[model samples]
Target: MSSRQRLFTLMYRVGFAPWDGHPLPQALRDLVEGSAALPAGTALDLGCGTGDSSIYLAKHGWTVTGVDFVAKPLDRARAKAATARVVVEFERADVTRLSTEAVGSNFDLIVDSGCLHGMSAEDRDAYVREVAAVAAPQARLLIVAFIPGSSFGVPGIEPDEVKQRFARDWTLLSSGDETAMNHNGKNPARQYLFQRAV
Candidate 1:
């Protein structure tokens, strides 16, 4: 089995995955809902865990496609969408090798919630190129992950790195750091948002 498949299988066996959080992250919901002038178009949710954001986006009228490397999580994501009565296409594919054709052409909006952090440097570079290639002009890309000063295993990617990776094809619209405190007030996290250039 592929590494991604193994990862998913392990996650399912452990009964927990980064993308399978309950209640979802408020930061993401707020980001999507508050973005005034959000065009109704195709949206891609990369590494969509349990399909929370995917289902939410679909409910808001965006045709959503969620991609994940793990089949176990994709299964859960699809079930979540079905239960929510939201139509979301969930596919198991490695983001590093993701093709535009697999996503049905370019996407108008792409959201990556905690996927980039897990990638090695080489994979991250490939991911950046793949994303740039598939993102439509002026597409909005929202990313949420642990930043510097966090205990997350993945090293934090600086804003400069983000720009270096995407600026050739994307523009940094706005970015900020948020301390995402959960119910227990522990396991704080960080997030970032950007927009593709026209």
Candidate 2:
């Protein structure tokens, strides 16, 4: 396994996942709820640790599938879904190696909260291809990631990079600042919205 994969595995094993279990990001909530909500449809949550976002989508009337590389988080996610009285398919799979057989296809919406920013550049390229392979025409995608060279002091992605990478297959819909994530006060983040080109 890759070092990053091993780190994630170890984090989950020790219950040190600081990214799991929080209110859904406003950008995601706005897309699926309230006046401008998109219609209920098949949705995929990439790197769906503990499934909070996936459960939120399910409760909002979308058929949801949550994918995670770690096994322990998937267990918690399934239990959380059960407790919430929602059915969400939780799959243990790598986002860069997604396939129709691994997690189905033609998802109307795909969410990647704090996942893409952590990957190496090569993995990000694979991520873009894999996401498009499963997205339906005009499918909406929401990505919440730390902004590159921001106050977070961690490696992050830039908006231009996101747009440039998916330019051929997806169109930029919106890009805006996201609130601080975890205990990193004033951490600058950005949420990018895109739609698969028809």
Candidate 3:
């Protein structure tokens, strides 16, 4: 396994996953709740540790697939989804090397919370291409990532990088600071919403 994968596996084994169990981001919630909520559709949760967001989407009538690189989390996620009585397909796979044949495709919605920011530049490029390949035309994408230099000892991504990377395949819809995320409340985060270009 890659060092990053090993690190996450160890974290999950020790129950030190701070990224898990948090409430879904407001931007994500808006996609499924309230009057402005979107119609139920196929969704993909990248780096879906423990399947909270995947279960949320499934509970709202979506067909959800949750992917994580570590096997430990996939086991936990499957158990959680069973207890929640929501049918979410949990898979052990690297987001950077995702394949349509493995996870299926044409997802109408995609969510990445605390995932993309942790990847190397080459992995991020591969991730963008892999995601775009599976997204339906005009698919809505919500990404929550720590702002650059604010991820404590971990890597973070700048909003400019987010836009620049997705410029060709996605249209930037909106973005804002989400201060409640990250290891400490002091480090600022961001949520970017995009639509897949037709």
Best by TM-score: 3
Candidate 1 has which clashing residue pairs, if any? 19-49
Per-residue lDDT over 15-103 for candidate 2, one digit per residue giving the tens place of the 0 to 100 score: 77766655578889889875888999999999999999999999989999999888898999999999999999999889998874479
- Per-residue lDDT tens digits for candidate 1, residues 1-198, read 656457667867798554455555556677567666575689998888778889989998999999877677788788888889989999877777777447655788888877786666788898998887788877788876655555444565665666677777777776665445353655444555677777
lDDT of 3 by residue, 80-102 (tens): 99999999999888887787449
Alpha-carbon RMSD to native, per candidate = 2.7, 2.1, 1.9
Q: Which 10 successive residues of model 2 have the least lDDT summed?
A: 179-188
Candidate 3's TM-score reads 0.93
Stretches of candidate 3 above 4 Å error?
Answer: 179-187
| TM-score winner between candidates 2 and 3 | 3
Candidate 3 residue pairs that clash? none
> What TM-score, over all chains together, does every model reach?
0.85, 0.92, 0.93
Q: Note the Cα lDDT for every prediction shown.
A: 0.74, 0.88, 0.88
Error of 1 at 155 (Å): 3.8
The order of the candidates by TM-score, greatest first, is 3, 2, 1
Q: What is the C-alpha local distance difference test score of candidate 3?
A: 0.88
Q: What residue pairs are clashing in model 2?
A: none
